[model samples]
Target chain A: MRLSERELVSLIRRKLARSTASEGTIVGPGDDAAIIAPTPGEALALSTDAIVEDVHFRRRWATGFLLGLKSLLSSISDIFAMGARPRACLVSLGLSTWASPLFVEDLFEGMLKAAGRFGASIVGGNITRSNKLFIDMTVTGHLAPGNAITRAGAKVGDAIYVTGHLGGAALAAKHLFGGRIDRGRLAEVESFLRDDVAATPGDAQVELLSRFFAPPIRAEESSALAAAGICTSMIDISDGIGSDLREVCHESGVGAVIEIDSIPVFDRLPGSLAINRRDMLRLAISGGEDYELLFTVRQSDELRLQRLFQENDLCPITKIGRITPNSEGIVFLDNDGRPSEGFTGFDHFSTKEEGH
Target chain B: MRLSERELVSLIRRKLARSTASEGTIVGPGDDAAIIAPTPGEALALSTDAIVEDVHFRRRWATGFLLGLKSLLSSISDIFAMGARPRACLVSLGLSTWASPLFVEDLFEGMLKAAGRFGASIVGGNITRSNKLFIDMTVTGHLAPGNAITRAGAKVGDAIYVTGHLGGAALAAKHLFGGRIDRGRLAEVESFLRDDVAATPGDAQVELLSRFFAPPIRAEESSALAAAGICTSMIDISDGIGSDLREVCHESGVGAVIEIDSIPVFDRLPGSLAINRRDMLRLAISGGEDYELLFTVRQSDELRLQRLFQENDLCPITKIGRITPNSEGIVFLDNDGRPSEGFTGFDHFSTKEEGH
Candidate 1:
């Protein structure tokens, strides 16, 4: 049934309900905030995300169920990226006045699916009338003592490597935009978008596609990489290599040089929208929504790191760049021996006026 | 210096940088989510509230500093009202992309001042381009062992009491809106609005006007009132007596009979508004932005409650209503002995389409 945003909010409030003594909730909705006590000694890692309806998802994208899953997955991936286990999440859903009950329910169903998959609970949130459809998730997770990984640890001499293939998610998104897909084709696309492919699996080409949709590396890998004393600074190649690597340089107080020929790119992928292999590199470099981990390890451990990944049947590793002084900024050496001046990446909300 | 929303967001992000230590923060920003670990046993409390540009605050009612304080106070008030001590806060600021840096700074100053008053730290937030000014604060508060307070615990026949005076904050708000005060009049206004002016000392009324701009209620009061074994259920009167009480009754599965004459309306209250005295009752019942506590107590402990509040010099305790079966819903007992339907309260984002 069609429902106003107010009605949807009221329904959510009733369904979520207040916490009882048995629920271990000290404060629940209808208060200034909900409160919970953490198990002692654990440091909290906090994250917040805003999802604009049209920009982030399409009404025709899969079902409301898939849309919910993808929107939530987009946020959960951040928790996974932090190497922290998911804990409690507060979801703020902004419903335009004209939303429908079925639509809202389907969205919740999607969210529940993702929440269950990640083992996180929806603890508290605010539901209010909004001009646009916006869902913002404030996810809080705890870190085991000293297990949290950051982007600052990569050393200058460490070899730069990335996990997974990097263009399929964008491709999947493109396909969704183009129009309807058959069930079998959609299923294949779904599997391809899962977070594990690029994070693990050593087939160099398979891993190349993995980076495009979902990256698989976790804090455990960082622990393993760091424990072995093989890695220095690290970053996730989210906004493509060029944009993300720029952040690593800015954060680590260093610059970098990426050898275009050495950078991994997926080839021979079959999809409705066909493009040149050169464009794939550009997508790999500037095409975003890729969640792959990029890191720097000692040059000496380069061979060891490659062997480790290959032994685990993951993608073959590549040495794509070396960290340099800030004075170098970020220089990209193309296959033609041409150095590019600037990098381009996606800014989804930047182009719009802001209310999503 | 004047700054845009982007500049403001950058400042906030810089402030929060020191709070996070997670290595797994692959894509913190410029992406869909800030990925991180779900640390074990740590429960996260997420809360969000939005304040519109004009409805919530006047662009010139107070300094940008004070506006920021009000924004933070309004949101953080939710955390404290839950009996949870706030730990960190995330703000999603949606202002006209053209807002000046000075305006943004003023907002931050207000927010930081309020945070300092409550001992809560500002951690993370987002900034987006928007056509109108919208500041949404999502706060995470840490509840002590088994100590979160909700609005559902009111037992049958519990006496109701409100901390501080009612209507004074509303008075202060009205004064600020008319914009008649001069610079030298600040001290006079502050003195007149001081907490001591309430019929009783230590009443929240006088101080509330000052706090109206920023209501200061400690988390300790929850325990103090709870320890007295008098409060059955409680809520902060944000949307005025009538509406908030309706909420308390609805949550507790009961109804209430409010006496029109019994509600503590303010002295020297201006008559400038188009609405009349009866409408004033409507305002007291429904007008919002007042953060005074409304709580229920055992009938047997009514005397003790009065004495306790008196000892603390709190405003005169008044019993405006009593809880009845839900079938009664919420009724107002007029001097003519007629019962009126429910009162309308403020909904900040309500627009012409709502037909309120």
Candidate 2:
């Protein structure tokens, strides 16, 4: 049932109190403001992101728990991209009048789960009523003094790398939004997956959909990379590889030539999904919401970086390309080494509008 | 005059760049996240607040610039209440499709003005499209290590004080919303005031309206109090003195008795305003959005606190009440010194909905 604003706030405060305060939390929730003890000799990192209903996700496409998880993860990804360790988060939620208390509880549960996983605390937040649902989160992280890895540090001859495979989230979004698959078939698959029954041996589509619904935040992997001091530049692939790579290039005044064959794509889908190799490659290049770490490193450190990943048992790090001087722009080199076209990625306000 | 998302972001970034970065800002905007160096041995203070259209304000009630200023000020006031110095702010704006580029720019201009006024920089933010306008701001502040003044520090016999005269904002809101004066009268007064023509000698309504539209944030006064170690407990009067006083009492396990004659009320208004003393007292006690500082100090420090405020030329501080043992509860002693009933204050989701 819907609760009064005061009741809702009390409920949220109680739910959030379940999260143990970290060492840096001098004052946790329930005060005029939270006080966090600074990690001495470190610089603080701050980033904010918002997820609005229909703008970012539809309630029908995911559960409240998953939405909350994704909202916090998306904001944390920005901190991770900066090679910082997230310490605290402040969530500002705009709730619709129709929202039930249970729904809000589930949302907070998801957020707390994510925060606990990252070793951060939900220090403070505000909630207000609105016509639509929106969750705006601000995350604070920290790194060693003067040791932040920025998007503006990529250099010529740097090797490009990305953690984990891409395209799964895009493909899942396609199915959820009825891009190629019929709505009835998509519903059937979703229902089957939600029923908690074991999927058939060849049902990779369910796995893809799960990944899209609850994408992982690469905090551990990013921390390892940052601690190693190996990355020349870094960013999280929230807006697809092409768009994020362009950001790195534009910021660093460099270009890149990525080998299409070397770019990782989800390949376990059954043939029944009717997705061809070309479409898969296109999704990998242009689709967004992967939440993977993309970074550039000096060619000399490439081997050492790979060894570091292996030693830490971190996610697979793939060498996808090399940074070039600004003249070449960003190019996609096919298997035969010929530059290919149509490497555009998602833009929220592009002329050709695409649902996030 | 609507701008694309990218253009709007670029405009905001350019405007924010006018705010010089503090020494603690290691990396500013245009990166994955901004990096800040923490003051050594200090604790970080954080607060998030949002202003939602129709709920918190109406489009016709104030200009976009005023709305932006109020939003930032309200959040910063939380930091001030905690006896912290605001360092930076991250603003997340949800703009309706109908909002013009000029409207957004004016909003940002006001926010920047407020940030600059408090010596806090707009370090980073995010903007997204929504069905209604909402500005969610998160402010970061700092306090001397272990020196934060909390709402739970008040002791029995401590004297309570407020920074400025009250009821002006509440009176203004009443006039704007046709509480006693009709809408047409409010419109006429607003027009007269906006025209920059001289108000007739008895036009106290105009003065009240102006105060309501631009209530000041008591940052300087709060900082001075914090630095001097005078306040035992503190809070901002965003929800009126009664409500905020109740908060402090509840947190500190104390009770209070406020003298009706001692409570500051705006008395400069002429009879044309049509507000009686009873209504005026009610407004002062129950009206929200005053943005004044309500603090408690030990009885021994009261005179010194007043002298310090006067010496610093800070906002006028008035003694309003005295803290008592929790057994006494909170009482309002009328002019005749008799306890009064029905001292209810504003609650956003109370059964009796009060306009904010």
Candidate 3:
């Protein structure tokens, strides 16, 4: 299990060479740094995100392949959120001595698949020893100048919208973290994900694991939204709505008025937990890891945005709120028009440390 | 000092917003991704490197600033190794809950200083909670198309040369990790580094620590070498001559004959610890973290490369060996021309775990 760093790097290089090499690369893995040609007339978008073993995820909760896939996809999500197509990435991994070379191979295979599906070439990376396993990926993309949709453009009258299901990933995380899944079920789920035969739609455990294991892909819709010039501001819901909403509002100097009942809830949980409707609503509002695009568009462009989404087979968008003056202070009204209170953004990862 | 991730990110944004903003950035921090306008007609060189709490350096040995400075600079060295100018970087930090806000501030100050010195803008990054502190940096640089100096271009008759001192970083690391200094001296060294009063010329302790704390900056030298178009292949000496030479030789499908006596030695140790010449020679060849440039130039271009360095007052280069056909293998010869045996690459960081 004590594989040399050189061997791991060689393995990664071989996997990438066979699968992830793109034309713009002048030099790929095995160099001091990867050299890539920037597309003519396009700017580059850069982002970095890391998955520390216990911080972002627990290894036992998913297979190595699923873990690798999610780690790369999460970073790639940033590029898509910027309305850019991911082109290349550098993955820095810190593997403990207990990890097998096969684990490294499986991990890279997952990353290769994710990059290939998203069109990002595996360009360069570093391998080193650590007491804990961590995957830090930096992904870059091509974007036309001045075309990025940032989180600082929300206007007072713009309507707030989100693509895809909300709070499902968080709910999935809750079941796992809340210790609802037994060891036997965990093994089965991990095996399914490891074998990539995860299509058992009727199994509640597999269904729940899939949501956290694989958030819906949002790159195409983000590109479409940016191209249409309809979204005034955009952000991905990696953190729950409460946190993401605060970011946009704070940056844009705006407040928001959200309709609690209008917000689309991801209620596809695996089993009957007897959770009340109010609890489900709160989960929808506070859960993180959704990877869904949350954006705003001027009222006039709302129709055009809707038509564009309709034309393409993209995730449907829901109008959950509208931007308001900064003085209003992000007000949210319940279905009865009463102020919805005390639902703060829930950062599940930061709340507790898993005892290893 | 369990500051929220939000507050830490806000601190980073404020620091970067005040100091590191570059013109090409359409969006900087506080966004999902940073958008940078790639320099016209230039390819990009991307690299990542990380420093974990105990794996890379002990906090008692150096202040947060030096740790931050070295971490970022080491990554930037890769861009230079490719003969590119550092442009922008994303830093992903995993901080423990007990870490203070002041530590975070000082850390970024160190990174900002390095980035500022090397002309790289702090574009985007993520701050997350971790059981131990780690800083992972991904740096991108600009290089003219087809101008990158890769490690796969060396050929037979190519002269192997290196810039700057070698083995000094490993020697310094040995001193600190071997417990050469007590708590009082460790505190003093940390204070000296924390205050950035690093210019004590004659203090051996300070000098020894300086070598490890602040690696030699080689961006300008690398750019000059690449621009000169003399080096047939190049690599940064992060893992000492032995490991790096293996990289170039393996990639280029060639071998090398090195005169061990001719290799540059970073012999400016603070004071002698009764180390023999043979051991010092081995350390010089096997020690990692030198961050020097090990490269090859054709016999025909050697004079021109030497002339270019002399004209620019650049760090002097030494001709240590010549590339051989793969059948010759990578052989090292001592001053007596006898076959030098058993001086393999020394990977210090990967050798032992530092007990926290």
Q: What are the chain A TM-scores for all the models, listed individually?
A: 0.76, 0.90, 0.92
Residue range B223-341, candidate 3, lDDT tens digits: 88878888899988887788899999999999999999898877666555436667777776777788888999999998899888999988878999999999999999988998899
**Clash count list over all predictions:** 66, 0, 0
Sorted by TM-score, highest first, which candidate order results? 3, 2, 1
| Candidate 3 ranges with C-alpha deviation above 4 Å | A182-204, A272-274, A348-356, B182-200, B272-274, B348-356
**Each prediction's Cα RMSD?**
6.3, 4.4, 2.6
On a 0 to 1 TM-score scale, where does candidate 3 land against the true structure? 0.94
Q: By TM-score, how accurate is candidate 1? A: 0.79
Output the worst ten-in-a-row residue range by lDDT, candidate 3 chain A: A347-356
Per-residue lDDT of model 3, residues A115-159, tens digit only: 887778888898876677888999999888878999999999999
Writing each residue's lDDT as its tens digit, candidate 1 over B224-285 gives 56456567777778778876787788778887777777776655443432335675576577
In order of appearance, the predictions have TM-scores of 0.79, 0.90, 0.94
Top candidate on TM-score is 3
What DockQ does each candidate score versus the true complex, computed on alpha carbons? 0.31, 0.62, 0.66
Please, what's the RMSD in Å of model 1?
A: 6.3
Worst 10 residues of 2 chain A by lDDT: A193-202
Taking candidate 1, what TM-score does its chain B reach relative to the real chain B? 0.75
Which prediction has more favorable DockQ, 2 or 3? Answer: 3
- Candidate 1 lDDT tens digits, A1-356: 25533455566655444222213344554555666555467556676766655555545444545556555655665555545566666777665655566767766666655665655656677765556566777766655545555566556666678765665555545555556445555444345444332234344333333333233434345445544556665655545787678766766778888887777765546544556766777777776666666778778878888777766565445678898877877788987778965445544335222112
lDDT, candidate 2, B1-356, per-residue tens:
25766678778888887767767787787778889888887889999998888677776665666677768878988999899999989989888876777778768777776777777898888888777788999999999966788888999999999888888888777765654555465455445433432233256766676556556677778778888988889988887788788889988999999997888887878567757888888888888778888899999998899789889998787898999999999999988899977776666655434346
